[model samples]
Target: MLKYMLMIVFSTFLLCGCSYSEEKISTFEGQIDYVSGKQIKVDCSNTVAANSEESGDQVGVGYICFAAINGQTKLEDNNGNSLSINDFTIEDKIKIFLESPKNIGKSLESRKFTASKVILIKASPAPK
Candidate 1:
């Protein structure tokens, strides 16, 4: 009887321990369309697919997303080097880890996608 009770307690503890992990953040990848201060607009048209499209090519509409960077957000470059927003430029490819959208405004142009982290995958080419 004591052995069975111990097994039940151990199983409970294992289940509880496995459930206490960091919340998962959603990720989006695209090229930078615009950047101002801590805010960035990503042109995800080539990357994101609309829900209506089952073939993944029926829709021709562009999909752009905006993300806001705060002090807590982590920024890193392709080489795993630490970076800042200043290091980013238009046309740069980035992967954004976003916090769930809260009160996303009606207008897509005005909607804000809060980012928890931003990783730079490729830098834009320098103009000759």
Candidate 2:
């Protein structure tokens, strides 16, 4: 009984030590597509999907990343001026700094990650 319990605990620790995350901050520049209370959807790509038909743009290979904002996420302008989340709007160009998982035989861009910093590159022009 005790032997089995210790073995399980050790296995759990070992698994956690070899986590899939890369422990590195990765960044990508993109335009904001959707924004909610604490999460934002960013359009980060514009290429065509590999499996899409070559006739036209059947399936877009565009990558949209959903970033979850928190107190730690620093929202700033291009000049490093602090800003509020409300300042963000659709189509705004921004660069997001986030922690990415290790590229384990897959594209990490397809997964959502917590945004560490959001820097507004360019705000969409005011609507008429």
Candidate 3:
């Protein structure tokens, strides 16, 4: 029994260690459909799923971006180009890098620059 437990523990540790890769970068490609005040609505590619969403009784994933802090933030692109969050117009295509919520109480509160980093990949006029 003891040997079996030790093997399970060792396997867990090995699985975790192997999951870490230096070259791995978290990125999401999507289109911003709406922005009101600090609230944002986006629709990602059908192939990819949203990490977070408002509410749903569905299987697929979708996300929304809202200001957690009543302050300004800097938006950047995948190439490291930066833009003022205030200047972000609606219906822009973007690549966002988000940090998963660290605490339950801080889920929505984690949307700020202090809590999360947002990178705007590409911005284009809404398709007419």
Candidate 4:
């Protein structure tokens, strides 16, 4: 009787341990630095608060991070047009929603983020 009880308890614990939970998502704004097959490097140097009164200077020394894109990832432009990874170009500003890295408190370059969505922010017209 004791052997059967131990087995039942062990099975219950094993099943509980195998359950999965979704990872939390985080967002960051930056410019596209590089793009490859299914990955991109972002230069998050110019991120700033929308309502701040600052002179548009970068908050601090920004670090570049790479994000992986998957089929489930959503991509869109400011005009609500759907886009693909191939539409991105270097120097294009974007806002990215991604899974926060496990070691977030560590140095900037040590973290890894996986992108879930990307929104393109239109660039301003250049002076002639």
Top model by TM-score, which number?
1
- Which stretches in model 4 have alpha-carbon errors above 4 Å? 1-25, 46-59, 100-110, 123-128
Q: State the C-alpha lDDT per candidate.
A: 0.72, 0.73, 0.48, 0.68
Reference-based TM-score of each model: 0.65, 0.63, 0.43, 0.58
Tens digits of per-residue lDDT, candidate 2, 83-120, equal 99999999999998875532211254554778889999
Query: Which stretches of model 3 miss by more than 4 angstroms?
Result: 1-27, 45-73, 101-115, 126-128
Clashing pairs in 3: none
Q: How many clashing residue pairs appear in each of the predictions shown? A: 0, 0, 0, 0
Model 1 lDDT on a 0 to 1 scale: 0.72
Report the lDDT tens digits of candidate 4 across residue range 11-94.
999998886433333776788889887888887543322222334445434557677888888889988789988888887888
Error of 3 at 29 (Å): 1.8
Error of 1 at 18 (Å): 36
RMSD of each: 9.9, 10.7, 7.6, 11.2
Return the lDDT, model 1, position 3.
100
Model 1: per-residue Cα lDDT over 1-128, one tens digit each: 99999999999999986763322327767889998887989875543433222335644246677898888888898777888889999999999887763432224743467888889998999999
Residue 116 local lDDT, model 2: 88
Candidate 1's displacement at residue 53, Å, is 4.9
